[model samples]
Target: MRRALHKWGAAVVVAAGLASGGLVPNAIARTPENPSRVPPVALVTLPPEAQATHKLILAGGPFPYSKDGTVFGNRERLLPLNPRGYYREYTVKTPGLRHRGARRIVCGGTPPTKPDTCYYTSDHYASFQRIAP
Candidate 1:
């Protein structure tokens, strides 16, 4: 039937898109508590500013921005879900920027310094790549 063929064709198009990474953009793939879809970046691969921010976070700061150690609500739900106050955000200084930039490091867990996981987002909170330790 023509209807059956159209349905089959749509499914094939979707399947091809998934296989080629055309349809499912990072935002759509990254779901709450399912960071498996999120990409991973090595610690050394991060920008120098991000690396420094990471260190400050572990050292419990002397953070440059007052909001550095504040809670990250993760309202975007790009990250794995957790209780309130679980995630803390830190700023990665952008070269020549007078104020806090979009680049940031967000880590989740207790004790501030030793987070169970950390993520880097160059485009603010639009997307996150898990930091592989």
Candidate 2:
């Protein structure tokens, strides 16, 4: 009878230790939720000369050229120029005409490949200029 009681008591102590040591599986971890926020969009228009200048700048030319072919005195400053939304960068590559061969270059945002392509904005996207290339 005594041996039986000792065995039972030891078993009870082991079970209690296991329970307090987190052997159970129902415990849950807490996590935070994401915030709700949306950025605004800007609208801008450029003159004929500015548009032409922008295009010339896009093309590898007399304009200040960065390794990425972006015509900006300071890239960091240009990025946040428009406060409304995030500024996206893009690169376009096209086959040159006849002997022209192939051309690969980077541009701000996304520009239309066709000559008749045009863009318009209402808020000031920092500074707006036409891409003539």
Candidate 3:
């Protein structure tokens, strides 16, 4: 039992290191300037039915509009009707601006019967530009 446990621990450590990209060959190493953001796109295409369903869902309501939008709800429990499902608020820097200000972004989720939208605020949520699709 003791020997088996030791081997299992070593295997776990090896698996973790490989998962973190430590096992990649030096020839295919990535540069510091251009880091990978997303995984490679799949070459084999989805069937027409699957593709159509995906398009419908992606095109569904609560589309992610801007980066500034707000996101609420714990990962475990999410409610669509709540305002938390719609938008997110963020701060971004503008040209000639010493500091950043509040901005709102839309969240992508299941399509609502009536799409919920958010507006970008210039003066700290005082006003907003109603973004329409």
Candidate 4:
């Protein structure tokens, strides 16, 4: 009876962990609730420069680059297929760089400040990784 009770208690704890959302090891990651066409980027994993750029974007920046907040146009179609001018681009200042580096943050929506989505490009638009959703 004692052996059976201990096994049952262990099984209960395992079941409880799985039921409490994916806060446990080997659990499936939680995805965005919205029908997001793009994946999400965790701010913690990004580079320090990219983190700073994200902060500037949220704060409505007085960005250092002359072309800091210009229309991205989404010509490459690398983004999740948005319409014309739905995206705007911002520069991520690189260390010891005199000009705008290849890294950029492209966001979608009107007013630029309230984009529906945002993507980070490190390869000058050869590819894009979703940064916001």
Top model number, lDDT? 1
Q: Would you list the C-alpha lDDT of every candidate in the order shown? A: 0.79, 0.28, 0.32, 0.66
Write one digit per residue (lDDT tens) for candidate 1, span 1-133.
1111122121111122455545544323333324335579998999999999999999998999989989998876677778999999999999999989899999999899999999999999877899997
Candidate 3, overall lDDT?
Answer: 0.32
What's the residue-level lDDT of 21 in candidate 2? 51
| Each model's backbone clash number | 0, 4, 9, 0
Residue-pair clash count for candidate 1 = 0
Candidate 3 TM-score versus the reference: 0.29
Full ranking by lDDT: 1, 4, 3, 2
> Candidate 3, residue 36: CA error in Å?
41
Candidate 3: minimum summed lDDT over ten consecutive residues — where? 1-10
Candidate 4 lDDT, 12-55, residue by residue in tens: 11222345443355422212221123457876677789888877
* Candidate 2 residue runs with Cα over 4 Å from true position: 1-44, 64-133
Shift of residue 132 alpha carbon in model 3, Å: 2.0
TM-score of each: 0.76, 0.21, 0.29, 0.66
Best by TM-score: 1
- Pairs of residues clashing in candidate 1: none
lDDT of 2 by residue, 8-118 (tens): 121111122244554434322111121111222221234343344336544534443233233332132322233322232222222243321222222334332222222
RMSD of each: 8.1, 23.7, 19.3, 14.0
Candidates 2 and 4 compared by TM-score, better number? 4
